[model samples]
Target: MRLDKYLKVSRLIKRRTLAKQIADKGRIEVNDRTAKSATEVKVGDQITIHYGDRTVRIKVLALNLIAKKNEAQDLYQRLD
Candidate 1:
């Protein structure tokens, strides 16, 4: 899946447009390298998102086109 769509579908960024904007601004990274909004993301890929002074890192566990609210968190695994 595209990085922006994955982010929204996984409920990471809440909205696809926001996710796209974030990715375009170079606030998102994959495997420690800057990632664009259209970057392909797959299972086991490491994603890091910068939010101000805080950073969120996660490993893609699964990819789904649709997921229930309670199941959204299952898409990725948080990493230190």
Candidate 2:
């Protein structure tokens, strides 16, 4: 799955557009390397996102096309 879509689907960023913008700006990383919006996300990959005043790290647990709000958290496991 695309990095941006994974973020939204996993409820990390709340919106795909915002995730895309952040990824484009080089604020996101996958497996310790800078990642683009279209970067492929795979299970077990670590994703790190730099927010304004903090950072979030998570490990991809699964990849699905859609997830309900209540089930979104199951898609990734927070690492920080």
Candidate 3:
């Protein structure tokens, strides 16, 4: 899954376009390296997002093309 899409599918970001904007701003990282909107992600990869004075880390648990509100949280495990 692409980083931006993953963020949206996982409900970490509300929309795909917003996720892309955030990724484009260098506010996101994968496995400790800066990640782009199109960055490929797979199970077990770590993702970090920095916004304002907050930082969130999540471990990829699963990938889904479409996730319902109840299922979104299952896509990633919060690390912090």
Candidate 3 C-alpha lDDT tens digits along 24-75: 9999999999999999999999999998899999999999999999999999
RMSD after Cα superposition, model 2: 0.5
TM-score of 2: 0.97
lDDT of candidate 2 over 28-56, digit per residue (tens): 99999999999999999999999989999
Candidate 1 Cα deviation (angstroms), residue 28: 0.3
Q: For candidate 1, write residues 8-80 as lDDT tens digits.
A: 9899899999999999999999999999999999999999999999999999999999988999999999996
Off by over 4 Å in 1: none
For every model in order, what is the number of clashing pairs?
A: 0, 0, 0
lDDT-better candidate, 1 vs 3 = 1
C-alpha lDDT score of every prediction, in listed order: 0.96, 0.96, 0.95
Superposed model 3: Cα runs more than 4 Å off = none
- Give lDDT for model 3: 0.95
